[model samples]
Target chain A: MILVNENTRVVVQGITGREGGFHAERCMAYGTQIVAGVTPGRGGTLWQDKVPVFDTMEQAVRETGANCSLIFVPAPFATDAILEAVDAGIGVIACITEGIPVQESVKVYSYLKDKRVHLIGPNCPGLISPGARCKVGIMPGDIHRPGTIGVVSRSGTLTYEAVAQLTEAGLGQSTCVGIGGDPVTGTDFVDILKLFNKDPDTEGVVLIGEIGGAKEQEAARYIKRSFKKPVVALVVGATAPPGKRMGHAGAIITGVSGRAEEKIRALREAGATIVPSPGEIGVTMKRALRR
Target chain B: MKIHEHQAKAIFARYGIPVPEGGVASTPQEAREIAQRLGGRVVVKAQVHAGGRGRAGGIKVVDSPEAAQQAAVALLGKHLVTHQTGPEGVPVSKVLVEQVVPVERELYLAIVVDGSGKAPVIIGSEAGGMDIEEVAAIHPEKILQVRVDPIIGFQPYMGRDLAYAMHLPSAVVRNAATIIGNLHRVFIDEDATLAEINPLVLTPDGKLLALDGKLNLDDDAFFRHPTHQQLQDPEQEDPLEVEAGKYDISYVKLDGDVGCMVNGAGLAMATLDVINAAHAQPANFLDIGGGGDEAKVAQAFRLVVADPKVKRVFINVFGGILRCDVAARGIVQAYGELKTPMPIVVRMRGTNAEEGRQILNDSGIPVRLVADLKEAIAQLQQVGRR
Candidate 1:
């Protein structure tokens, strides 16, 4: 019931591009229903001769009634594509495009304030609901299994690393969402945690955080007060140098605020189980679940 | 894309913000001439990307034009290394010549996107001319913050709030608000990631001027403003990093023996962490990203091998969007061309893992394939020993 499920009707923006075409096919293979595709220049064309392709998001939404928009547009044009999706009334939008300008993200984020929309990422791997067999964006589908734990992360492959470990421990996920490691992202940890809290399938939660930004600390505060589910966390880049962006744009420590130690202390004070290292997440999550 | 102080001041001046009359001089004679025009009392500041210029003697106050020339001669054509700049200092090509102002109080002002809040935040502090981070760490109450709602834009009320919080005198309250509003306008208008004035000084004559300025434009937004692309200084950047950027891959060279090439940034950092945990330092942090094709992988391999300090190469990839076989082919191609004697360890998982491993084995390139990060690190250590 959180974000995406089995009956999610998706529309792929920039469907004519390499990533959009490729990932749209992958999402379909993972049992997600992609109803339509939008590419401005190539309207009335059938994508792979299956999904109907329209010139505009409005046309696609009017035709297919797609509630979700999966964006694979390039970075520079991503802001407009996201706004188009929002304008066309997409309830949930997962933007897979990375390297969208921070200023553009600021504008898009501000625009989302008044709308009833949930945007996932401008640089994220998107989300997957294992039990419902619904996959959106770019995360590999095979590693996920339907179970009781919910996962949220600020990284791409690290999410897979933890999920693979959870699957190895015979623990499956209700849903996994990558909120993106960009400084400004659409969906926040608290927003996802709120959804997971309401989700009956989610018995436990795992947060995969990295160095940089105060999102993790804020999430810890929210968990201490509102959340009742058992939670465990793994924050990477504990040894990362200051003032250096650790690959992700948002994963850079600017001042004393966004350090890994600070986030760890806050999460610990909130009673969330802290995984000492990325390799220890599986064991730590199992211990947390038992408690 | 961090612009020099002179450039930032130019931008600030255009936004109707008060700035000292200054000119950028490429030579000592030019500095002297600019100082002569600005009047005898002037400051000659080295124009470099790194900060802490004053402490490094990169900044000097000159009582006469000859002193300004001597200061310029002492700075220009010399390497200026501050605490911020690494051991190999950045060369000073230019200097800013400006008239010195009478400072009554130095206040801090800037506009930056607060990542956690996902909005533009205006940060101002009473404790200025010092490291704002240290001020924020010691006395957080001194820092005044206002998160701007973009829909309403930067309102005058928000600026007033900041001015009041900073406890500015009633005489300069409106001026402070206007400056704060102008800074926010510059932040948005220039598509800047950061627009800051280190010492927005209030003159004894009740005039406010931006003493030092810094602006960092968003590189991703270069397409929107093509002219801003011209501001990039490749000479000031690491040659390897600049090369990697052409292929859309992120590369940061580190002083270690094992070169690491991974798929995602988080996983790349994790790979570095795992390598360090195994008592080995990483040669570099290179993320090929999720869109790695054969060419990108081959290029990434070339960059890794190009590092003379790299004795061994470790490739850790999680083949989700990027198929493992593509990476395998890239490695084989690069090894065939470079013919370097450096040992290579490969860790391939998900999406045609078996096929990728098979390709590596058949290449007969002596590429050792590991199953996961733990094995990859162990293999790296093992190869590092031999």
Candidate 2:
């Protein structure tokens, strides 16, 4: 019942832009179904001579019956692009745009509360389901493989790190989601954890969290009460100095709450085995499952 | 970016939030003149990003202009070591001189983007002279938060809720509500991530004043507010970190031997953690972003090598949107020009890893290319032993 699968038809927002066009082509090459493209004022023009471009999301959805949107618009215009996709009644919206204003995200998030759309990122790598060969966002398509261990993280490259190590350890993934690193992002650990718990193909889960925010703590409580899948967690920025933003906007230590140590303690208490080192992520997941 | 207290107060004043009369002074004499102009009793505050200034001897309440001058002379040229500033204190070049306000009660108020809620939240507390965190840990019942709907903006009911919860008197209830509304307006108008008034004081004369203001404007929204962008102080940050920010590279200095330049922040911190687990500390945290081109790569290499503490460089790039070959080309170019014979452990994964590895192998630089993160960490540890 996870939103992404082989049957998911995708639309590319800002398909005419450099980053958007490049990634859109790559997503298609990786066997993701691309049905439509949207770029204001650049309608009627075909992208890569295959996908049809429309002036607005409404036209794109009406013409192609696209259910999912992969947004790669620049930061300044990303907020409008996300709201536009939501307005057009897209079910799954995954924004790959980085550096969007938090205030803009606030408006988009509040608007999405009443809507049926499941938004992914305002600054994230998006998600990939290897077994179904469905990829959305910017994760490297080759590093993933079809298997049972589900992965969720707050960072892009680190998500790749987990995938590579898991693949190397002979444990493939069902779906890997990067929930973005911004202070205000669409999807959080709890949202994706709930999805993974319901996915029949997913046997276990790997939660890669970091410092900043209480999302991981909340996810820990959810795992304790509802989730029964074996979870191996990793929280980075253990040695990070306070008040210093570690690349991701959300990966900062603000006083004593957003500390990596605190997150580790919470995850461990919730019956999730905490991997203190990145090198031990795959090995620990294998051990946690007794596979 | 974080703006100083004076700048925050200035923004707060413009938004009609009640603040003390103040002006920034670069010299002690200017501070004294400003103090005298503000009346006999004044407060001299060191303008720095870090907190706990009062305990750090950065804030002084003086009765006369001579006392203000003495406080400025003692603080202006000295480095203030606050609990928030870590071991290395920030250098003070300016002070904000303002008229002192007598307090009846100290309250705390702040507006911040609630990350989990994905909305702006207004936080207020009755117990507020101390750190908000302390108040939260010790007396959480005194604190209250209201998440505002961004579309409808900060509603009057929300302000009224806070006023009623904080137990504002009938006389200052409207004033407190207006301050809350204006604070939220400034948060939206200025595109600030955090706008706080610690010790939103209730004066002895029955008036609420924002005694201490702190505002952090979102860097992503800097283009919209050019005036807020100008408030950034490069002098307040490490030179290398400031330089790295210009190129969209995130660099933080750490005391270690291995210098790490990774693709993303999460991976960068994990790389440092992995290296630390292998019994070696990372010298610096340098993330060239996900789309680091050859120019950014070369610049990152130069920045890493500039530090004398960095002995061996560990370059870990996960080629996702950034092709591994592009990273490889950058490494080769930096090594060729710099001619630094530092043993570099290059771990290139994801897309085009084979091509990236080939480029590095052909470069004939003393570089060790490892396939996995574990192997790379082990390799770095061995290099550290050597």
Candidate 3:
């Protein structure tokens, strides 16, 4: 069941920082084969949880055969950190930092050509494959159980909401990935959906999304084009006036075209049984199962 | 951050953009003195956060200095209701005392984000001093839009064309072009999302002057301009919503009894709508944002519970990217701290959902695990006596 298993060791970039240290400790606790932690000048030392530290991604990957890199570097340094991970031959790169400059994420994404690597997020919460026990983002460790529902979202908190609901509905997850909040994200929704589609264990899907980006529309198109399982969607920003910025800062979807109505219309048109409230996710999934 | 017209003018003047002489005062005596100093009939305008001050009697033409003082006295500390400032009304914090200009021709000019394009766009009209929304909806023909090229910057030809559209006198056209050019520079340089000049006027004497100015800077851009921080007018804003922004939670208080909690803004709003669709009212819309640690989630629960208006509770989150288990831990942690004595319906789904449910089930918290979004609403509906 492990497509990329324990041998694909992880190197934690910015291992000295708050998010990095916290998640690094959690991932190690979850039994991820963590090879090394990367924090410049913190090399030759050990993380509080006793993971060996290295000065750079190159050194860590070179020395320990760490092919998967999880970056918790702050915004300004995130660009360089992801690139270093990619350049260091990391097969999978998860940048778990929010507020990464959009332009920087784009440049890094654009530069990823010819490299057979998967980039998850520059603003995402990272991914978790249950029972494997490795967590590379801020998602808590207590709620996961190895089950069949595959989860993907443009939101971090909403992802938790859907997961909780699915578990209560007696559905478990194969993998949960936070695609992040940035407008220009590293992975498209379809990319993760495809992964779930291929996983035999993932029977159904719960996709939590918000208004603004064309990402949901693209997901809708992908669903209509290929996906067969009953997909439940929770699209946020209803009654939220389009084009006015909020706490996500400048994220606003305005006018007749980008409003919640249009996105919901597309989602519904694509055969997604839309769950109006995140609170109803469990109930809705139960209903979906019965159908 | 929003500053008054006079303050905006002061800021604009520093950037070498020509503005008509104006002074702000909180007292009647100060208004009279400013009017006398200007040596002309004055415009007494209430300093509030809304438009339509001219039609609402908030703005008055005072022929004499004494009349200016009387008008200032009447306007000071008074609440001026306008369409933009909402029902609570914008409080008259001060009075703008300015020389009355004789207008031969008027033009409207503004720079705001094109909500459709997600770009800063310049809007200009031959008709000045009008409600922009009305102008946009009605006489859109008069409104000339110029897209500021992010790369090459605002072209000189765009300014010249916009100036020509205003049909200013030859001497004033050059001045108008300079103002438009400077406005573009100011907009990009300041990281402003909206910079408007209402009644950008041509006086009968053939001088071009900016009668009023308004600028709304990008909140994210405020980090770069520390000195330009302005106080939010609470009377013109939502207190709970404003307070929530400080805690990094996007919260909007609603008239519903079911207090709803979710992790994404879009999801939160959808939750509210679903609550409504089920004929249940949502008490509040709360998003815990992307940083979903136990503390942040705990705080989100705390905020939901804080609302006395809320009767039953609906907790929903989709941990598609967030681990379902982490969310469960956060829920258990918060439920432990408060004992959350209220009847709670929780629907958490996505990755690690099964494990997350096990964590919650083990927590011994008296929380209902709803089957989905609608059933949770239906359950909340049954419990709501309100």
Candidate 1 has an fnat equal to: 0.64
> TM-score for each prediction?
0.96, 0.96, 0.73
Which 10-residue span in candidate 1 chain A carries the lowest summed lDDT?
Answer: A237-246
Q: Please give the fraction of native interface contacts (Cα pairs under 8 Å between A and B) kept by each candidate.
A: 0.64, 0.85, 0.27
Best by DockQ: 2
TM-score of model 2 relative to the true fold? 0.96
Model 2 over residues A147-189: C-alpha lDDT tens digits? 9999999988999889888998899999999998988788889
Q: Could you give the DockQ of candidate 3?
A: 0.22
**What DockQ does each listed candidate score?**
0.69, 0.77, 0.22
Model 1 chain B weakest lDDT span, ten residues long: B229-238
User: What is every candidate's alpha-carbon RMSD to the true fold?
Assistant: 1.9, 1.8, 6.1
lDDT value, residue B56 of candidate 1: 92
lDDT of 2 by residue, B206-323 (tens): 9889999999989999778877778998878878889898888999988889998999999999988887887888899988996778888988998998888889999998888778
Q: Which stretches of candidate 1 lie over 4 Å from their true place?
A: B337-340
Q: TM-score per model for chain B alone?
A: 0.96, 0.96, 0.84
